[model samples]
Target: GAGVSQTPSNKVTEKGKYVELRCDPISGHTALYWYRQSLGQGPEFLIYFQGTGAADDSGLPNDRFFAVRPEGSVSTLKIQRTERGDSAVYLCASSLIGHRGELFFGEGSRLTVL
Candidate 1:
């Protein structure tokens, strides 16, 4: 079984740009979550999807951030009008529901806004 993986482990972009971070979750897992972690801080929940629908997205900072899990598996985080404050590690995790699960995190997509 494959663990979650993220692309562009590092990304640098200017202010007011757009960026998309991809995440590949573990096979057969139906629960996917996205979290943003700043330096020396715990991961802040961004969005969580159970199956093909987003169960919780209140953690998304603003409209600039959005995510989707069309096939109930892989997901992507899209950020528009990127700002320096958006610089952080975007982590993706997946787990088995109701199984006393622990989220398995990806290396993370580190975004740098300059």
Candidate 2:
């Protein structure tokens, strides 16, 4: 893809359900990130992947959230036991390895826990 791509632009589920969000980054980009944005706040970092491994996942709120970039090109965020408080827009961004500040972001997958 020429830019970052995310699937399921809008997802609404009852609380306690499991959800998965996908992100396909720009070709050749070596860094990918997951972020969550609540109603009016800025995107909050959830995880960062460098190639096939996650270099930082400390920002994830709890054990229920996890992410994987198996081949270093596409990533998926998995949420277990979703809660209403988890409703937010999940954003994905990618950039060249050395260019952390220049990220290309996807439109985001909005998850609404009902």
Best by lDDT: 2
User: Which sections of candidate 2 miss by over 4 Å?
Assistant: none
**lDDT tens digits, residues 58-100, model 1?**
9999999999999998899999999999999999999888125
RMSD of 2: 1.0
**Residue 23 accuracy (lDDT) in model 2:** 99
Cα error, candidate 1, residue 47 (Å): 0.4
Q: What residue pairs are clashing in model 2?
A: none
What is the TM-score of each predicted model, taking all chains together? Answer: 0.95, 0.97
Cα RMSD for predicted model 1: 1.3
Quote the lDDT for 44 in model 2.
98
1-114: candidate 2 lDDT, tens digit per residue: 778999989999999999999999999999999999998999999999999999999899999999999998999999999999999999999989634469999999999999
